[model samples]
Target: MNTKAFLEPMGSWAWWRSWFLIFFGCAVMGTGFVLFINPYNFVPGGVYGLGIVFHNIFPSVQVGTFGYMFDVPLMIIAMLIFGGQFGTRTVLAALFTPGYMNILTRLVYPDAAAVESLDPALLLGGRLDLSNDLLLTCVIGAVVIGVGQGIVVRQQATTGGTDIVAMLLQKFAGIKFSTGILLADGSVVLSGLVVIGFGIGTAEAEPAGWMLTLYSLITIYITSRVIAYMLDGASYDKLLFIITDKHQELRQFILEDLERSATYLKGKGMYTEAMKDVIFLVVSRREVRLVEQKIRSIDPRAFVVVTDAYDTYGEGFKPLPDADTIQAE
Candidate 1:
């Protein structure tokens, strides 16, 4: 179990780039939690969601600190179950998010009074609190959080906690990943109902109420859509199937210029009974036109079929199962 090699990215440049993206994602997500979501107590899911619940009960403890309380144990569990395949990058994400969240909390709220003032309240006896712009805050905060999470996932890392729970459920219960995520997050959301409550206005105290819960669900939905869009959205990448006579030349172009490999399939034309070489390859949407142009140059009559590839994973693309998984295999 030499985890050193598995924990390290294949090359130095790649290692640094992955870390940069992971940290950047953490910062973005943390900022959203501190400035927008935390102020209003949205409880959007993850360890942070639980943090908000705890914060409501115990205002003295910081949400980010509570996140750490959940994350460290989850990290340990991930290491034990997934081993090196769980990756050091995931551990970094788990730690970076809460750490940065604490940093952002301090920067935004320097004193106890500022933190206490975040709850929904009235100003000057009759006016509503300006900071309680629920709709706009939820939408904007969801977008920010979604994009940040998408970036971290693109690096094949996670911020731990419930994500680990979802993975374990998927592994042992034969549950799909998406389903597992929904179930886990949905449970957290339901818990929020109890923590935040389902009520309207009260003269004595301001409760989170059912309305905030509904708004929280909206934010979660928006965040999921944004994450989906960032991850693979429509037309992000395409699978090209080119049937042409100039197979060798096209293959060479793909290998050399495109720096991508292709698969060649032998086929016979139905009408002419002539042999044909079908080339199957994938290219980013940005590179589709160039690849098409190259194909035209090589063979004017080549029949090309282009289809969307939502997500692609494998060597030369996404990494294979983590090092430990590969070893076990």
Candidate 2:
């Protein structure tokens, strides 16, 4: 019998438990952005941040709310790939975050809130209305947003955002959740830098441009790291499995040109029933192309497989070596 088919439906009690997590996560997502992003007009991370930057660059062109604009499309895409719990969870997060942010916007009534103790350095910076204490905003905002995000992920829920796209790509696009995340998030950050510079007034436009650039970069970095950590797909590596007749030649090339090591696994082709040598090498993702080129040069018919090894261990992988150690090898 199929294990899931044998399982019973989740009860209302279980349903509410998930909703509770989503609600809290959404609340944090909303409140933190309002305090940090909107007040300072700092762009959001990923697509949301990109929207802000886009508006800044092209004042006449108005996209919808950043969260909602990204959420609807992203959730739809995620649902198509993941289905069921994963899809539903992302939809709820995507929808709820924006709504909650709107509600929180009204509640906070920026004018109504008693003057909270802001950092002294920010007031001294004199960049804008809140005072240009970018350091405080960046660090505090990351912590505040990251905490809520961590909680939701721990509960296996989402805080909305482009995380839905990341999840979808992970399931169907044959991509890691973290890599997709950086792409989605970084995509927004990059767009924002370009868009935020559209206005005419130097005083108004200059600050927006600077803040948008800074916010997009930092937020994308923070969110990407946080999401990858939560989802267990965070790293910077490419795992290469090369099956070649030229074993010693390929091995030496990596050790010398790439400054890497390989483990020779004696494998066999199931179909051919012929013995083969498979060389396993772990290198930075950027170096994959070069490695592949060398493999082709040495053995054109070699079977090469490249994959995102989210995390790796052992010699010549990441905790890395000095130039001397690499050279000595």
Candidate 3:
């Protein structure tokens, strides 16, 4: 068989993996909404919270139903503008999530009045009955909900609804993604102020819904920042360079004492007729500190430069150097 010929193209496996990832990501996000926050009467940031607002304002409306209905027109617009991949993923998230949500909402809330929280911690720590306060609900709700969204993003998938729309708005309308999401989610949060014949606008009405909304925003912000920090860079390694006349002494000392590697560069001094050696080494951040200490000790006049490098792939940086050379150093 022509193995090389077959290997010439990247094939079906990539597409299958992408689909699996999309399904898994959506399931995790849907689970977060259904299991943790929905029955809790708290909305997390983004479209999920908007669904909460929708259900609250119109008690006859189901959040899952709202998600399903709201996503269709957006998906259609996205499909027409972006093409099949974007539209397909949007469709999958919108269709699958509403059923999960509707099922969960029924199981948790069907005529089940918000019973007094029997948990001692809730009774003691939360002064009022747990059923009524939006603050507590939002605080706890955002954590579960935000984590769900993070999992989908980490896997490079969408939770199906407004996430896709946010992305489209960012791409076509030149709005920032974060800004677009804030607008979409903020509108949902604002509607929460007027749910179920209660209006927070009055001096007497507690702004419980808005409290939860703010908490969700804070939680979502913190969660996304954490995710970005984790993915942005690996901070373990650094690069160093020394330009000096005592290159041989420094090179031998570094190579022998620290058991590290260095590259010597050939250079001509600007005025004097003298050759100089520029030594370069890649090592851990700790080693960079040590190297600086040693160079200053050996010759205070030696010029040095250091930089942060993401990773080193060969020799001492990543894969271990030959054991013999290491021991010899």
Top lDDT hit:
1
Global lDDT of each candidate: 0.73, 0.60, 0.57
Cα lDDT over the full model 2: 0.60
Off by over 4 Å in 2: 1-15, 54-64, 110-130, 172-174, 198-204, 229-329
- By TM-score, the better pick of 2 and 3 is 3
Q: Write the per-residue lDDT of candidate 1 for residues 1-329, one digit (tens) a residue.
A: 22574556567888778778989998898887776788776878888988887777777788888999989888888777876645576787888898888776665554665564444341222133436578998888899987888787667667777767766776687664444555677777776777676421212223646676787788787776776666555444789989986778888899999899988888898999998878879888899999999988899899999998766777566554543221100
lDDT of 3: 0.57
Candidate 3, run of 10 with poorest lDDT: 320-329
TM-score of each: 0.70, 0.55, 0.60
RMSD of each predicted structure: 5.8, 13.0, 10.0
Q: What does candidate 3 score on TM?
A: 0.60
Q: In candidate 2, which residue pairs get closer than 3 Å at backbone N, Cα or C atoms, i.e. clash? A: 44-49, 46-185, 57-195, 122-133
Better of 1 and 3 by lDDT: 1
Model 2 superposed RMSD (Cα): 13.0
Q: Across residues 193-275, which tens digit of lDDT does each residue of candidate 2 receive? A: 55455444322544457665676467656755664464343456888888887888887888888777778888889999999
